[model samples]
Target: MHNSIERTPIRAHLTDHMVIVNAQAVETGPTRRPAAVLIWSTTDQKIAFSDPKGNLLFEGKAALVAPEVIRRLRTTDSTFFSLNFEPGNRHFLPLSRLVARQDFMPLKFDRFSELSDELQSRFELADYKGIEELSDELALTLLPRTNAKHLRDERIDLLLPLLESNQPPELNSLAQMLHLSKDRLSHLFADDIGMPLRSYVLWRRYRRALLALQSGEKIATVAHRVGFYDHAQMSRTFLTLFGYSPSILKCPKFIRISGIQSN
Candidate 1:
C-alpha cells in the first residue's frame, strides 16, 4: 500500500483568499470539484467534468473549477498547476468571474505561459527556496488587471480566518460577525466570491481533510479533527468533491504541492 507519499509543499505569496499550487500527480486518480484556475501541462487532455446533475462543463487542457461540484480526470502522471481564489481573495477576479458564470470554464494554454514555463524549467530542479520564490512570482503574475487595486470585500476578509478554524462558524453566527442578516450575507458572499458560503465552507473543510490524510493521520482522526461528523461524513464530502473515496489520498502515487497553511 502506498501510504502518504511526500513532496515539499509549494510556498505561495500570502494573499487573502487566493491559492496557488504547483503539483505533479502520477496516476493519482480522479479529483473532485477544485475551485481554482487549473492549468494542466498536457495538450488536448481529454477531460470529462460535470456538475452534480452530470451536465458536461468542459473538455480541455485548462479549466477554471468552481467550488462544490464533481469532475473526473482522463489521465494521471501530469503536471497540475492551479491558482484558486476564495472570498477575501480579490486578486484573480478575471478568473473568479469566469467560475461565477458556471461550474467550469475552458481556458486557452497561453493564459498561463509564465506559470507553465516556470513549472517546466524549475519545478524538478529547484530547491524549496527556489520553488517558493517561483511560486511567489507566479502568484503576482496571476492577478487580473494588475494595475487596479483588487476589489476588496471586508466581509470576506473577516470570514476567511473563521472558515479555517477546526469548527467553522455557523452561517448565522458568521453573518452576525459581519453585521448582516444571514440572507444578505449569503447573497453578498455569492456575489463577491462566486460561490455560496456553504459550498466554500465545505471546500475548506475538504482541503484540510486532504492535507491531514496526506500527513498520515488516520481517516477517522482526520474527519473529527477537521470538523466532519465522522469518517463517513468526511468520505462523503470527498466523494462529492473528487468523485472518489477519500482513500485516494492514501494512494502510493499521490503527490501534493501543498497550498498555504490551513490547519
Candidate 2:
C-alpha cells in the first residue's frame, strides 16, 4: 500500500524551548523503529509524550516513548503511533534542562480541549497526510503562543535566520550575526528557546538526515551532507540526542524517529 507523502514540516526553531514536528503515515510498516526524542523536564525530570493515536491504529489516545526509550526497554518488536512535544514554561513546567530520557516529569496539553468542539468530535482523523497543514499552523502559531513569555519570543527570533538558511548554520556565526557571544547565546538560547543552542543544531542535523534518507541517499552520505564528520558520528549523535540509531529510519518516513530533545 502507498500513502501520499508530503515533505516533512519545516524544522521549527522555537523561542519557547518547545519542540514540534508534523508528519503523517499509516501505522503499519516494516520494523518501524527509528530515532526517538529524549524529553527531559527541566523542572521535574520526567516528561511525557502526547498519546499515540489515530483511527488508523487503535482507539482514543495513548502515550509512548520511542526508539531510545523502547530500546532501553530491551524489546524490539513493539510498535506504536507517536507525535512529539516537549515544552517548558515557568508558570507551567518551569523546566531547566532539555534532554533525552531525562527522567523529568511527563507533561501533556489538553488534547481536544485546545481544539474547537467541532474538530474535537472528529475521532478518526486518519493520518498526518490529512492534518499536516493544520498542524503546521498550530506549531507555528498556537504552540508558541501557548506560553506567553518574552524569552520564548526571543528564541523564535534567534531561529529566524537559521530557518532562512539553505544549509546548516554555524551557531557561532549565527551568534555573531545576532551580535551575542556564544556564552551569552547559550544563556539566551535556554532562556528564550527553552533548549540549548547545541541541541537545536542536532535537531536540524537530524531533519536533514531524514530528508536524505527519504531521497534514497545512504545514511553515511546523508550524515556527511548534514555536517557530521561521518555516519558513525551521526549515528552516535542520533543515539545520544534522539534515542535511536541512524540506521533505523527509512526514506521519508521520519515519523518512525520521534521527539525533540533539548540539550
lDDT tens digits, residue span 37-84, model 2: 322111212222322231122122222333323222111112212234
Off by over 4 Å in 2: 1-80, 86-158, 163-171, 241-243, 251-263
Against the true structure, whose TM-score is highest?
1
Candidate 2 TM-score over all chains jointly? 0.49
| lDDT, each prediction | 0.60, 0.40
- Candidate 1, run of 10 with poorest lDDT: 7-16
Give lDDT tens digits, candidate 1, residues 109-173: 66565557665565556444555555456545544554565564776767777888888889988
Query: Each model's TM-score?
Result: 0.69, 0.49
Error of 2 at 102 (Å): 10
Off by more than 4 A, model 1? 1-34, 42-70, 76-80, 86-88, 91-93, 99-117, 120-122, 125-150
